[model samples]
Target: MSAPLEGVRVIDLTHHLGGPLATMALAQLGADVVKVEPPEGDQWRAVDDVRGESRVFHAVNRGKRGVVLDLGTEEGRAALHRLVDGADVLVHSFAPGVAERLGAGAAELTGRNPRLVHCSLSAFGPGGRRGTDVALQSESGLVAANGGRVMPVPAHDTVAPWIMVSGILAALLERERSGRGQVVETSLLEASAALAAHRLIEEDSGEPLFNRFVGALYRTYRTADGAVALACYAPRLHARALTALGLGHLLDDPRFADLPSRARHSDELAVLIGERLAAEPSANWLTALDAAGLPHGEVADRPFSLLDHPDAAAIGLVVEVDDPTLGRERATGPPLRFSRTPPRPGGPAPRLGEHTAEVVGVSVGAGGGR
Candidate 1:
């Protein structure tokens, strides 16, 4: 079976995680993605925290061909124009106005190919005063929102790529009907703002109660080993939770009988539940919770290592790539899966200018040729 985007050609001028992830998604859908790098190559290629290679870079740029060029040079610029001339999409993450300066802006590229989809990624959006600024995680409100809380992660950077990818796909579908391409834009700020959609709604509702309460039983509790997150919001489940914890007598107590009253005594309830959970290990509690049909699970304590995760392997989340320079390495697989034509690992990350000669039809130094 043919891939969904088998005939589509994408010129990827993106660097770092966000843009590459977007292009990777397209590549997974069978788009012919040609990654164009500067003479020095992407900065992410140097992130060697793991033993072998930069798994992060490999994860995002799989299923695509790589070509390095000095875009500042006349020859390189000319070659890039040639590649864009036949391309269906162009993905870039340069700061505001940089693309225009490089003569590869949305307006310029779309003028050359009217049907070409141009996707731009940035730290901030094009509208704000900091549009051109490359703000780190703290400036985007992402780190702040998640920090000092129970959950902490760099959600903005991690989620921005997927959002940009979705935006690009939507733009491509729109082009199908309109026969005219438009610029698809996403930013860490915007993506982060989108993530706060729920909080924004709650804030707008102007209800103090909505902000403060989490129901009585639907919260985190400490177990003997670690912690267990439990959700017994409904009356029946709450009763079951009480019985499972040997607190069935609390069901008769008027202070913990109803939802509103339970909220009022949440602290007391939490203390009681904590005391009970402290008596048993997390594994025992998990088994008991499962038997009681209570929604609870042991909270993992270890940091997430991508290597050898069962879900990752079962769903093809990681793939092995044989690199001519780095030997063999395992990196993340495509985020999407197609029933008809599933995406395959194209190859390992290329060396600087690895395909310059092949792409531009000219020979370079030794170990490089057409």
Candidate 2:
């Protein structure tokens, strides 16, 4: 079957993680995405730690064409308008007012392309406040979720991008009926709040929803070898875990009778579970847990390499791509699967304005020179 978005064209003015990721998703689904960068290119390409090269840029920008347009100049604005005339969607990650300042505002772009699906991704609510990655992470309570410690990764940055995708897809679906494109907006703050919905509390009368573990069942236990994360919330699975681990005596214990009681005495229960789990290798515990149908996973100490994993291949998570600068490399493909038209991973990221002439149909040189 043909790809769902095979005929769709996207004019991507986004940069960095959140905005790039949204366009990346559409690109994966077979949209003809043209990334419009400035003269020097996306500032992210000069990320200091990358030493003048950006692997993160390549990772998120694969399977798309590229153009360098100086939106700061009239020529740049004219180029954008020309591209907009033939496009179906436009996405950006600038702050609320930055687009207008650059003359690429919603009103201006929409006037040029009325059927344009304009997507804006920000750190806060639309037109509310500007925020940085660290600030949004802290504001979203993700920092507090770790018990006041900073997260090792950009967790909020990871989630905010998908939120933008959600809005973009919804807008596209609506356009199928209305034949009119609308503005789609999403923020890191909104994504963070949605992710923490379960942990949010109405009234904190000493019961912060995520301050502590509810029970010993939902935690990691170190065995003779590595550790395993066991999260069996079902009562049957809870009983099965105890029985499988030869700790069935706790089933009759009054303190462990119910979920609330088990949570209240979680400290005591943790000690018992920990001691038993440490007696054997995590592999042995996994055998018993799998047999009893209790949810569990072995925690990895190193980055997960899927080269040797059969399951990763089975799920179609890995794909081979040829990068212009880096040569052939194994990259991650789309997460979601489709029976008719699955997402097909494509070639490497563009070289600056590699496809400027082909995409814009003009004799434009690389970067912003010509």
Candidate 3:
């Protein structure tokens, strides 16, 4: 069997993380994705988040060809329509009304290619009275929920891209039978709300229920030399973990008697676990946990190199991409695996406009476009 999207072509007009990462997901699944950048390159390329590292650009934009086009000109817009004629999918992350002004609006695009699955990622949904430039987390209400401090993870920037991937895939699936394409819309607002799906279905007690990580043996703890993240929820595993830690005596204690009481005294249990855990290094605890068949392991930080985490390769969680400019760098691999048509590693992230002539039939330098 061939890769799922082996013959698909994607036109990526998204700039920052969410949109590019979405297309990257498709590319990893075997789409011939071509990213279209403005003359100055994707705005993410200018992001200096890690101080001299191209974290935003190289990381999210890998496994795709790139072309530069100054859509401010008619020629550039013409080139886009040409690309759309042959594209199976078109994804963009432009702000409200911006795509229309640039002749890349959904109506214009579908007019050129009615069978195109147009997926759009936006900070807000499509039309609005007015728009303000804000961080995705703020727009998604994550900052308010986190007491006004913006978190870098699980917010719209990262989570929304996966939503885009799903939306695109669903649209593609629909096109299979309908013999037509339709618009797929996803936004940071929707993505953030998805993070709180439980709130939507649960009864409104009118009391805020957040920061619920108070259960015993179901959290991270510091060991003598490192930390261990333990999952002790299952009844069998709960007993096994306590026996492994030699803390079975805790069951007889009045304050920590049953599972309910143990949950109520999660703080005390944590302290007691910490007291014993402090007596040995994480390696020893890991050995004991493994021997006792308890589900636990040492907590690890981001690896600066593969040497920092020898187990990264062993687990198959990360894949290596030979970035043309950044050299060999590790990126997250495709999340899924197919039995017969398993995805293969894709090509490196392209240099800015490196494929302009080949993809668009013109040189970006011909117009002083980056």
Candidate 4:
């Protein structure tokens, strides 16, 4: 079947993670996305981590044509407006006033193309000072909730892209009815809030137990040989886990009577469970947990080690790509599927200004005169 966004045209003036990733998702859904970069290339291309190359750029920017525009010049601004005039969507990651200064602000673009779905991906919501994903994590209480340990992944940055995609799609759907488009905005701060929505609750009784990761009965434990993550959130699962671990006698204990009671006495329960877990290897405990229908996982020694797991490959969760900068690489497939109008796994990311000539009818350097 043809992809869902077969005829959709997108003008992508985004950089770094959030905006580029969002526009890439649109391209995967078969939108004709034209990625516009400045003469210096995306800022991600120059990050210090990778030295000579950028896996960050390669990871998120795929299946889109590329164009170079020196938006600092009037020639570049004029060329960008020409592209945006015929586009169905325009997404940018400019700071609050940057877009207006560059002449690509939402009001101006939407006025030029009334049917355009204009999206702004920001570090913070409008009027807020710009911040990075790590800063937003600290501000959003995620770092504290994570026991002051910063997550290895930039959670807010990664999540903001998907949220932006959702917002753009929703706006496009609404435009169908109104015959006009509107601005759809999202920020890393907003994404951080959405990521921790469950924990953002208030209760007059007290602070809700934030134990999904650290609860005695729900956290990872060291087995005799390796580690295993166990989760006995439901009463039935708790009973089954206790029975499977040969600690069924704990079921009759008052402190372990129910969720609240068990939670209150979690340390005691953890001591009991950890002792039993330490008596056997992870394989043995995993087998027992499986038999009891408990939720569990074996902790891997390295991150992304499960990329080669058989089940991951079987489910099409993993895909292989030959990137120009990173060489052959293993990457994730599309985030979702549809029966009739499914998204296509895009090809490798384009090199900076790789399609400037084809996309703008001018070579990369000559694009300034477009």
Candidate 5:
């Protein structure tokens, strides 16, 4: 099947994680995306390089042509305007008001091209101070909620891109009927809030939901060999787990009778369960859990272990691409699938100014700075 955005064109003016990830998804959906960088290139390109190519940059910038336009100069800004005039979408990640100074603001470009889908990505929403993943996580209560330990994964930076994609797609769908495009805005702060949405609820007494531990449920326990996560939260599942682990006597214990009671005596109940689980290897516990129809997973120490797992490959979650500098690379595949218009994984990320002449009819030397 043909790709959904086969004929669409996107002008990418994003840097770092959020905006680049969104534009990368557009390219995966078969859009003709032209990634515009300043003369020095995206600042992220200097971070964590492999053979002079930024692994951080390449991870989110696959399958797009690249051009280096120094938006600081009139000539460079003018070149960007020419690309925007004929583009279907434009995405930028400038600080709140920097886009206007660079002449890439939504109002000016969208006014010129009434059908343009202009998307602005920010660290924080308008009128708020600029922020980052760590700051937003703190402001959104994620840090406090997660026991005051900083998260290893960049939750806000990762989630904001998908949020941007959803907003941009909605705008594009609306344009089909209205014949006019609109501005789409998303921020890391908003994405952080979305991550904590479920935890936002509170009881009348001001007690937050799920704040207390509930026995041996919804947490990881160490086994003889490794660790396994158990999630027998519901009453029925809890009974099954007890029965499966030869602890059926606990089903009738007064202290472990219900959710509230379990929370009150969680430490004792956990000791009972953890002791039993530690008697066997993770494989044995996983097998028993599966037979009981309980939810569980054997925790993997390395995150990249999933790249080679058969389960991930079965769902097309892994893909391989050939990079000019890094050779063959294994990364995540396109997450969405359609029966009629399936999305395809994009090719390798382009070299800096790789398509400048082909795209703009002139070669801009690869000098540093915009």
Candidate 6:
């Protein structure tokens, strides 16, 4: 069976993670995505090594065709216009004003194709005084909410891609009724702020206690071998957690009887719980916790390699693709599944200008444009 978006064509003029990931999601749903790169190719092509390819680039660019065109040149820009004229969707991640300067602005393209769904992904939004400013992960509120006073991984970069895809999908659905495509815009900053909605609500409620570190009942604890995460939300589950650690007597203690009091003494409670958990190995503790109806899991110490995982294979989460230069390579599969038309993993990421002749009927030159 064909995919849901089998007839939809997308012109992907994006680079790096955010925009590429957004276009990739569309491709996974069966859109005919044509990735347009500059003469030198996308930045991710040579991200870390000089082998002229990066696994991270291939991971997101899979299931799409690639073509190179330097929009800086008049001839190249004209070629892009031709591609855009036939496309149903267009995605770009240029800095503020770059798209307008390159003649790919929403106004220009939408005038040409009223049914085109144009999606723009940026660091900051196109509104407010700081609209043109470059907003990095640190500047976004996500780092603050996720790290909680410390610098943790910037999940916004990964999450912003999904937000962009969601915006594009919504626009597509709206166009079905309105019969006119619209510009869907999203920023890393805006996406990050939405992700911190819960934290923001708690702060506005005047009960800053919700954001307090000590208020957590589920958190990381040191075990005999390594760290483990504990999550006991319900009062009964909290009792079960104590029982699992052989500390059932604590449940009867007046000072530790209720949720609020337990939170107030969380630091002392954590220490006591850690001491008991340290007596048993993580595997043993996990089994005991499961039997006692407590929620807990052992923390993974190292990154997961893709040699072969049963779950990944069973759920079709990973796919293998053959690359001419890199030989055989594996990458993450599409995130969605359908009953009638399932997503099909396409070929490996293209080499620089690999499809220039095929897409534009022209050859690639050093300075760009045939």
The models' CA-based lDDT, in order, is 0.75, 0.80, 0.78, 0.84, 0.87, 0.78
- Residue pairs clashing in model 1 are none
Write the residue-wise lDDT of candidate 5 on 191-273 in tens digits.
97788887666668867577455747878999999999988877667777878877889868998877678778888899999
Error of 1 at 194 (Å): 2.1
Candidate with top lDDT is 5
- Over 4 Å off, model 1: 49-53, 127-140, 147-152, 202-205, 209-220, 231-237, 325-328, 363-370
For candidate 2, the per-residue lDDT at 124 reads 74
**Residue pairs in steric clash, candidate 2?**
none
Lowest lDDT sum, 10 consecutive residues, model 5, at 361-370
Model 2, residue 111: displacement in angstroms?
1.9
Q: Lowest-scoring 10 consecutive residues by lDDT in candidate 3?
A: 128-137
Candidate 2 yields a Cα-based lDDT of 0.80
Q: Candidate 2 at 280: error in angstroms?
A: 0.4
TM-score of 4: 0.93
TM-score of each: 0.85, 0.92, 0.87, 0.93, 0.95, 0.89
The better candidate by TM-score, 5 or 6, is 5
User: On residues 189-305, what C-alpha lDDT tens digit does candidate 1 reach at each position?
Assistant: 886677676664444565664433535578778877788888877666777888888898997899788666777788888888989988888888888889998887566677666
Ranking by TM-score: 5, 4, 2, 6, 3, 1
Worst 10 residues of 4 by lDDT: 361-370
Question: Candidate 5: global Cα-lDDT?
Answer: 0.87
TM-score of 2: 0.92
Q: Write the per-residue lDDT of candidate 4 for residues 81-152, one digit (tens) a residue.
A: 889888999999988899999989988988899999989988778777888888998888899989998988
- The alpha-carbon lDDT assigned to residue 188 of candidate 6 equals 75
